[model samples]
Target: MDQRTNRTFICSVLFIDIVECSTKPVEEQIWLKERFNALLSETIKDIAVNDRILLDTGDGAALGFLGDPEDALFVAMELRDSAMNDQRDPSLSLSIRMGINLGPVKLVKDINQQLNLIGDGINVAQRIMSFADPGKLLVSRSYYEVISCLSQEYAKLFSDEGLHADKHVRQHRIYAVGHYEFKKATIGVPVSRKTAPEPKEAPLTDQPQQGENRSIDTQASRYRKTITLLLATLPQRPFHKKWISAAIPLAILVVLFAAFALRGGKGTTENPSSPKVVTAVPRPKPSVTRVAPPDTKKTEPLRSTDPSISQPLSSKRVARIGFTLSAVERKGLDITLTVSLKNTAADARSVALYDNHYSWPKSHLTDKGGRSYEVQEVYFRKGGKRISMYDTGKTGIPINGGATVTAHLVFRKFPDSSREAVLNLHPFIYYGWRWTEHDVNFPDISLE
Candidate 1:
C-alpha cells in the first residue's frame, strides 16, 4: 500500500491527446508540439503551480488538479478557446480531444527525482480521452457528478452521451461538454513553410447506400404526388347540397338500423365472445407531506406497503418549506441525491446548505441498521444563481417565495447492506434572524 510514501489523494485529472500526430512529418510534428505546449502553458498560467501537477505524454499532456475540481474544467475550457482563436500560421492548425476524471492518484518520484503520478485516476482519464473526437471534451461520470452540482451553469454545459465500453470491456458513462467544431486556427509564431497535407476522404462504408437512397426517394415522390392530387381535387365538390341531403337521410337510416341490431343482441352482450380491452393507467405520484414539530400531535405513519410513496420533511417557519426527494444514485461507495425544495412564503428566505465554520454537521444519511454516512459535499441552486461547497459566506442560498430550488447532496461510505436510507437535515435553514436547529428527516428513501 505504501507504493509511494509521498502522498495519495483524490484529484481531477485532465487528459489531452493531439489527433493524428504520428502521421505528420518530422518538422511539422516538432512545430505542432511546440505550439501545443505554448498554448497549454498560457491557458494554465493563472492557476497556481503548487495546486497542480503536469505530466507530458509525448503526444499530449495530463494535468492533475489537487485543489478544487473546477480548476481542471476551467483550464480545459480556456485551452480549447485559445486553440480555436490562435492565428499564427495556416499550416499550424491543431485538433485535440480532452477528457477529465476525478479519482485517486499517488504522488511518486520518477528516476530523475521529479514528481510523477501513477494510479487509476490518470489511467481512467486517458481512457476517457481516447473516446473523444477531435475538438471535443468528454468527462467521466465521476467527474461530471462532482462538477455539475457546483453550479447550474456548469450543469447545463453537459449533455449525457450515455454508456460506452472501452477496450478492457469496462463500461464508462461519459458526458460531453458544449459542442465544438474541429476547425484549424494558426498562431503568430513563425513556422516551417511546408504546407499541411489535406484531410483524407471518408471511407466508402461511411457513404450513403445508392439503393437505399433511391428507394427513399421513390417513396417520397409517390407521397408528394398523392398529396398534390388531393390538394388539387379538394376545391371541386363531388356532389351539391341536394346530393348531401339525400345521402344524410340514408346515413341516418343506416345508423338507426345498426342501433336496432345492437339492441336485439343484448342477450349476447351479457356474455360476449370478444376479448376485453385492458387500458394501462399510470400510477399517481406520491404527495409531499409537511413534517410537524415534536410538540405538535403525532401524525399517522405512511402505509408501509407502497414502494412508490416517499416520506419527506418540512419546516413550519413563517414561510413553510417542503422537500421532495427527486433522485438517488449509488456508485461504489458514493451516494448522490437530489432534493427539490419548495417555499410557500411570499418572500425569499435564506437557507444554509452547509456551513464548515459551524461545529455541528449540517446533514447526513442514515440506514435502517443505524449506520450513518457523512455528507461529503452540498450544492444549492436557485434560478440562475448557484452556491458552491467551498463558499465561505455564512448566509446560505436564498429560496424565493413559492419557488422551488434543487439541492444536490453527496455522501461517502454508504452502507452496502442498506436498501433504504433516511436523509436528515439539521440547523441549516433560517427561521428568522437566527439559525434554527429543528431536525428534518426524509424517511424510507429507496436506494435500489
Candidate 2:
C-alpha cells in the first residue's frame, strides 16, 4: 500500500471503550471483546468496505467512517441497542461507552506496518468516550451540528450536555444520544431472559416412547376383534350379484328423494293459506303537562373563594406538566436558566433536569432562531442554599403530585442576538423497539 496516498482524510471517528473490562476475569474479558467485535461488524455491515476502518483498542475499538457522519452516529446507537438485546451469557455482559467526533486524522504504519489512526480526532474521541456513562453514546459539537442538519429524526436522539473540561482540551461541548435499553442492559437488567426454560418430561402413560409399538399393536387387535364380531352378525347366505348391484342404485335414489323432501324443496312453491281478518291497535300519545319555570331571582350563582378550587382539571389526569422560563442571566459565554416545573402526575416523579447516569433524563433549550443549547450545570435552591443536581446523586428534580419544583439550568450562552427561547423538557423516550420524542414546549420567553 502507498503510505502517502492512503495516509489521511477527514472523517467521523467512533471510539468505544468497554466499561470495567480489566476488573473481570481474563477469560471473561476475552469473551467480551470477541462478542463486541462480532456485534460491531454485524451492525455496520451496510457501510462500504473501504469507507470504514475498525482498529482494536484491546478493551474496545475505534471505528472510522469516511461516508456520512450520520452513518457513524447510527452505527454507534445500533451497536448499543444490539448489545442490549444480545443473548450472550449474563456473566459475559458487554457494556460500552462510545464517543463520536468528526475531524481530520492521519493514518500511519505502526511497528508491525499495520495501519493505525493517530490525530486529535481519535484522541479527542477517546476522551469524550471516557465521559460517557456505560452503554451510552456521546458526540462532539461538530458531529452534532453536522448530523442535526442532515436528519431531524436523528437529531432528536441527541440532547445537549454542556461544556465538558478535558485534560488535553479546554471546555468542549458534548451531546448525548439517548439509549434507555442499553442503559438498563449495562446495569444488568435482563429485558429478555437469554437462557430458555428447560423442557418438561412427558408422563409415561401419555408419552409414546418405549411403549409406542405395544400401544399400536393393542389398537390393531381391538379393531380386528370388532371386525370379527360384525362379520359373524352378517347373513351367511350369498346373494345374486345382479340383485345386489340394482338394489344399491335404488337405495341411493330413495335417500336422495328423502333428503330433498326434508329440505323444503329448492324451486317448489308452497300451498296457499286461508286469509284471516286483520285488526289494528293504536299506541296512546304521551301526555304533555305544562309547569311553571323555576324562580331565577331567588337562585345565587355558584362560586368558590379559591381560584385553584375553581380551576378545571386537565382531561389527561395522568401526568400533568407545567413549565415556565423564570429567568435568564448571561455572564460572558455562560448562561444560567431558572425554570419552574409543576408536575401533577399521579406519582412522585422526577423531571429529567440533568444527571450523570447514562439512563438519566435530559432537558435542552432551543432558541427562536432554531439553535439548541444543552444544560451545562443543574442545581436547585433549597433552604436558601444551592444544591447541585449532580452532587445530590439524583437524576432529576423530585416533585410530588400536585406540587411544583424549580431548578437552575446553566448552558453555554446563546448568541447575543437571541432574544427568545423554548425549553424542551423530556425530549426523548426510548421504547426498545423504537424511540419517541416527547418534547414539551415551554412558551417562548424573552431573554431580557
Candidate 3:
C-alpha cells in the first residue's frame, strides 16, 4: 500500500450522539448502543465519500468545506435528513446535532498513519452543535454571512427564519432547526443564480413516518397532512368543534351585502348613516382548549412494546406546537403561535370573525379530581390602555354546544406579554390556512 499523507482542508463537521441512555436490561441497552454506533459510523463514512470536503469527529464530527457557506449549509442539512433516515428508530431516537463552520481544518497522520483532524473549524463546529437542540443543526454568524454572499436563496431562507440568541453561548445568533420542514412547504426557497444552472434540492422533510403517519398517502390525502397528524397526536379532550372551511366567509359576504342594501334605498327616502354597533352581533374568538393531559396511573394507551419508555409532554408539545402561555421560555426572534380550529355549529352555516384578545389564566391542581385551582388573570396589552378579553365576564365560546365547530390563528407571534401559568386555550379564527396575530401583549397580574 502507498504511504498516506496528512492533508489540510476547510470543511463542515457534524456530531452525532446517543443521548438519554435507558436503564433497560443489559441486553436491551447494548442493543440500543450498537444500533446507534452502527448507524453513526455508516453516516460518517458516507459524508466523507460523497459530501467529501466534509469531516466528522466521532460522537459528532465537524465538517470542513472547500465551498461557500451555501454549499456547507446545504451539505449539513442533507446529512441531517440522511442521518435520521439511516437511524430508523425514532423511539430511542438515533439523532445528530450538527454544527457547520467555514474555517481551516487539518488531517494529521495518526499512529497507524490513517488520519485525524484538529483546528478552530472543529472547535467552532462543536460549539454550534452545543447550542443546537436535538435533531437540529446550527452555524456561526460567519457561516451565515458567507451563505448570504454566495446565494440569495439561502439569504431569503435565513431572513424568514426564527433566530435565537444562543441559550448558553453569548452574543451569537443560532437559528432554530425545527422551523425547517421542507415537506410542509408548497413553495420553497429559490436557490438559483440568475445566470447559472440551478442546484437540485432534496425531498421534503415532512415525509411520512410510522405511528399514525406513513410515507404513503391514504385515500384522505390532505394538503395539510402535517397539521392533521399534529392535532391528532396532540393532547386533546373531546371538546365539540365544527370544521368551517366554507361557511364563515359566506356569512361575512351576507353581512356586507346587507349593509349595502340598507343604504341603497334610492330617492323615496334618503338612508341615514349611523353606527351599526347596535345591530352588530358580538363574535366569539376561535379558541381551542388542548386535550386534557393523558390519565396517569392507568394502562397507558397507544401500546408500544419496543421496550422503551414514554417521553414527557415536553418532547411532544414543546418540540412542535401547542397551547402555551406567553410565559413559556421561547427562544429566537420570538415564539410563533399557530392556531388550528374546528367548527360544530348547526344553525349557523359558519362562525363569525371577532377581535382576538390574548389572556393568561393561571391555575394549579391541588388534587387530581380535575377541578383546577385557578387564579385566571385575563387581559391583553400592558401600558395605560388595558384591553380585557373578559370584559363581558365570559371569554369562552358557547359555539352552540354541540353545533359549533372550530378555527385558529396560524401565523401568530407571541403576544408581547403572556399571562403566567395560564391553562386552557384561546384560538383565533382567521381567513387563511396560515393564521397568526402578532404584537399581542400580556402582563403580570397583581395579587391583591
Candidate 4:
C-alpha cells in the first residue's frame, strides 16, 4: 500500500483504559475486551466515521474526534453510564477510566501503512486518565476552558480538581466530570482556526476541520452585495435616469395635493383667517389593583393516574393548554417526571420546551427548604426520533390541534430531607416566527 505524508492537526482526544484487565484470566480478559468493544461501538454510533479515528490499545482504546469537542464528552458520559448500568453477568462486569484532552496530534502511517496517531495530545490524555478513579472521567484544563465557555449547560458539568504532578515533574490541571445524562451541548460557539505548531522541517496549514468551507451567507453579506450590484447596474440603465428626473416633480405635486386634501380641502387652516381651536382632554389617573399571592401551603389529595406517582395538587392549564402528570420516578441521583401536553386549539401549534442554544423560561424544582434544582435534560419524540429538548436539529415539535404529546423532564435528585417539592414549568408555543411563553407552577408535589 502506498503511504501518505504525515499531517498534524489540532483536535480533541479521548483515552480509555480497562481498570484491571491484565490481572484477569485469559478467558475473562477476552470477554472483557469484547464487551468493551461492543459498548464503545454503541456509544459512538451516532458520530460519523470520518469525523473520528479509533486506535485499539489492547485493553482499551483511544478516540480522536476531528469534529466538535463536545463529541468526546458525550462519548465518555455514555460509556460510563453503560458500564455502570450493565446488570447482566454480574461476575464479569466491566469497569473503565476515561480522560479527554484538546491538543495537537500527528497522524502518520504505521509499518503496515495503516493510520496511526502520535503526539502530546494522546499522551496528555493518557496521563489525565491515569488520575481518574475507576469508572470516572477526567479532563485536562485545556479541554475544559474551551468547552465550558461554549454553553452554560456544558459549564455545569465540570468541577475543578486542582493540579497533579506526573512522574516527570510536569504539573497538569484536571477537572472531574460530574454526573449528567448524556445530552448534546450547543455547538454554535466559534472555535479558533489556529493549527498545531510544526517543526522547522515541516509546517502545518492554518485551518480547522473540513466542511466548514460551506458557510452560509449572512444577512449583512446579502445586503452589501445587493447595494454593490445596484451601483454597478445604475450607469447602464438610461431609462432609470430619465424616470427619476421626471418623477421628482410628480412626487412634489402629489405631496402638495395630499396636504391640501388632508385639511378638509379648506387650505391653510392654521392661518389667522381660519384659526384652529385646540382642546385639552384630561387623562384618567392610573388605578392599582393588588393581587393576592397563591397559597403554596394548601394541600390537596394525591391525584395521579399511576400509583407509583404522587401529585399533591390538581394540575392546572397554562395558556389554555393542559399537562397531565403521567409519572414520577426516582433512581439514584436522578429524578424523571413525565407529562403529556394537550392542545385544545383548532390548528396545529409548534412547541419548544428547552434548548441549550437560546435561553428560555426554564423548568426547575424547588424544595420546601428553598433549595432549587435545575433541569438536567429533557426527552421527547419527534418524527419517530427520541430527541433531547433544545438539542434537536429542528426548531420545535409540531402537534396537531386537539392532539397530545408526551415528554419527560429529568432533574437532579432531590434531598432526602425534602419529602415534598414544587415544580415550575415554562413551555413556549410557536406562532409563525415568534414564540409565546406559557408558564405553570405545580406546587406541593410529593417527592417521597
Find the candidate with the highest lDDT and give its number.
4
> Which structure is stronger by lDDT: 1 or 3?
1
Best by TM-score: 2
Reference-based TM-score, model 1: 0.41
lDDT (tens digit, per residue) of candidate 3 on 381-415 = 32334434355233233233233122221222323
In the predicted model 1, the residue pairs found to clash are 86-186, 87-186, 88-186, 88-187, 88-188
The lDDT per prediction is 0.64, 0.59, 0.38, 0.66
What tens digits encode model 1's per-residue C-alpha lDDT throughout 243-345?
A: 3224433443544464466557466553343322211112223222245523324444222333233334333232377766666777777777767778877
TM-score, every prediction: 0.41, 0.42, 0.36, 0.41
lDDT of 2 by residue, 319-431 (tens): 35566555566666666666565665565555445533334446677775677777767777654667787665533345676676666777775677776565655422211
Q: Candidate 4, residues 1-448: lDDT per residue as tens digits?
A: 1222366667789999999899999999999999999989988887787678889999999998876677788789778878998877788889999999998888787788777789999999998888787888999988887666544445656777665545443568788886534322322321111111221211112232343321111211222343333356444643322133244344435444544665775654454333222111122232222323336566662444463654423556754567776667767567777777777787777666773445544687777778888777787855567867766533567778888777788887678677667777767665333345555677767655
User: Model 3: runs farther than 4 Å from truth?
Assistant: 1-8, 21-58, 66-71, 82-91, 159-171, 177-448
Better TM-score candidate (2, 3): 2
Query: Local error of candidate 3 at 347, Å?
Result: 48
Deviation of model 4 at 51, angstroms:
0.8
